[model samples]
Target: MNLYQVAKTVVYGALSPIYRFDVHGTEDFPKEGGVLVCSNHIHALDPPVVGILAPRPVHFMAKEELFNAPILKTLIPKLNAFPVKRGMSDREAMRKAIQLLKDGNVVGLFPEGTRSKDGVLKEGLAGAGFFALRGDAVVIPTAIVGPYKPFKRLKVIYGKPMDMTPFREQRASADVVTAAIMAEIQKLLDAHK
Candidate 1:
């Protein structure tokens, strides 16, 4: 197995019994091909929880600073994370994610572009839509509801895949597509939370 699979197995073994995350909608995840798993980021645990629970490996875009931190420098990459410069247009990182998706891999990121200061969901930036369009990947709008106390059964729901073809054909703006994706995520939060 690859590093991602092995690490996921080990992490799942350790975290499942402790966290016991209430994961939903695994079936919505496509069994193959390129996919963009966009979600609302709330906590530090958000990415790991979704990564471990996802049926497929998710290579997430992490803040560039994390890669230079003591142990995270070595460990984060093994978890299938790549450094992404935040608060600016980082062309290098964008190209990397687009290439990864084009090569038929799953790429996960937050539409808000950072953790929510409050637990409430916020407006999504255009980055997710940009990736969806450039990679020609299906977008999975996911939601994680949590204040994330230990032993709390937090919920993570993966909604249906959003095909970007309509947006592409219509030449829809990235902002419009991202708004729709965020709306879907909000709907999931409304239903489950």
Candidate 2:
């Protein structure tokens, strides 16, 4: 395994039982191709949760504020977390995400933009749909059922890739695509309820 894989495994193992991580549809994760792994954000732990549960290495875009803290500043970027300015489209961050996908790495994205305080999937921002369409990458809609108890059981279900070819060709509205993707994620989230 590579260094990142080792780091991911160690972190996940150590945090396991605490997160009680339950993963489904990992087999649906592409083994050797670029993929856009999009999920609803319900907690701060979403990035690490997806990273640990995903079959392939996953990269995430985080808020620039998260890197303001000294400890996180040092750690997050190394863990493949890049920064996006809040309330603005951080082109550089978007570029990095596209690069990762182009390089055949899985990029983790939260369509909700931020954690859902009510544990409900929020309206998706354009980032997830934009990246998928722009990158021409496969869209993997993931739903996380619970962040439950901090150290309790949580279920993360990944659905099959949604083809964006039509969306691309038709020059579909980003809001429409975002809503559709969130609905799909909500369906998965509802299954666990």
TM-score of each: 0.93, 0.90
Separately for all candidates shown, the number of backbone clashes (residues 3 or more apart, or on different chains) is: 0, 1
* Stretches of candidate 1 exceeding 4 Å from the true structure: 69-71
| Cα displacement (Å) at residue 19, model 2 | 2.8
| Model 2 lDDT on a 0 to 1 scale | 0.83
Mark the regions of model 2 whose C-alpha exceeds 4 Å error after superposition.
65-74
Decoy 2 TM-score against native? 0.90
Looking at model 1, residue 163 earns an lDDT score of 93
RMSD score of candidate 2 (Å): 2.0
After superposition on all CA atoms, what RMSD does each candidate show versus the true structure?
Answer: 1.5, 2.0
- Model 1, residue 145: distance off in Å is 1.5
